[model samples]
Target: MVNSVPDCDFTADYLTATEADNLLAHCLTALPWQQEDILLFGRTVAQPRLQVWMGEPDAVYRYSGTDFVPVPWDAQIRALCTRLARDCGTRFNSVLCNLYQHGQHSMGWHADDEPELGPEPVIASLSLGHARRFVLRPRAKGNPDRHEWSLGHGDLLVMRGQTQQHWLHGIPKTRRAVGPRVNLTFRRLLGAEVSAGRAESAEIDVG
Candidate 1:
């Protein structure tokens, strides 16, 4: 229902409030969340939020100068991926789980343009817990095309086609008192074999 952007879809209530609340409670205590250090501005620093990368065995992903070996998929997440495949019409082999403990935890502007994701990747983002602002802007400098949405609990946002190639998106840190939020971005990693060496270095701000 997001008409202002191309190759993007939004559903404000993807799941019933009860279902979302239950899932949020389970994820908060179940997922193995970790705060990893990432290279930013040529310096190593801890990521602002906690995260866990989960996927099929071969779905290794590399970003922000680090190679992440996929953790085995959790039962809840695997079931969600199956549902997303049916609903979004794309198969997802991997998922990046981000946990924002509060308003201060956030993601910075970056595109999911890594080579392993392929040229036109389909990204299905599911939100749980507190609502937060998600923004997108044209990657080209000063084009003035921008879009934002209040992604609340159980909302689903799908970004596909040329969205990553032409635009950059992120959730900025907010000063308001907000509760914890969890964002799951499901994706399909291409390539029959994982690359041996690092891809070209690019700064990534992930939550």
Candidate 2:
């Protein structure tokens, strides 16, 4: 509970900083043949991208109204998920891994609301390596509505409750000084298909 935010049941810990770093080093070295960078707004963005896959055979990840086949998991990743779940005070089934090479590499404005996420899905995020600004803004119109913080190596962020419904979060690209960072967001998609057409839609990797 080192970096616990106010009114946020979530807790961010640096307890396993060293271990996380060690695991990340191994991941960088052995995560199969690298995944191709996906196009984002026609920029063909690179690092800070993703590989949406499921852990179980029946597990399927739905992102941006699309489905995806999860890549196979290794021991290190499985251990990471276990640790993150215990730290976040919730359970997780799938993990979305992100590789951010530099300060310029970042995620944009968006909420994890794929309809498949259900109402108020719980999201546990783990950061390894470089530190960057993590910002959250209220979805509703408001004058003073910007919340930002720096998440360094080993920090864990758990967002729950009405967070997804009321706010949108992102890791904006910055020209500031930084190094490579890898983040894994663990999520649980309770077997519920909100719509029928969604099940047939092509899985689009719009990073």
Residue 5 local lDDT, model 2:
29
lDDT of 1 by residue, 1-207 (tens): 223475889999898999898889988999999998876667778888999999999888656667788889999889989999999998999999999999889988888887888889999999999999998987777678888899999999999999988888989888899999999999999963454333223434534
Highest TM-score: which candidate? 1
Q: Residue 74 deviation, candidate 1, in Å?
A: 0.7
Error of 2 at 92 (Å): 1.1
Clashes of each: 0, 3
RMSD to truth, every model: 3.2, 5.6
lDDT at 164 for candidate 2?
Answer: 70
Instruction: Tell me the TM-score of each prediction against the true structure.
Output: 0.91, 0.77
Candidate 2's TM-score: 0.77
Candidate 1's error at 48, in angstroms? Answer: 0.7
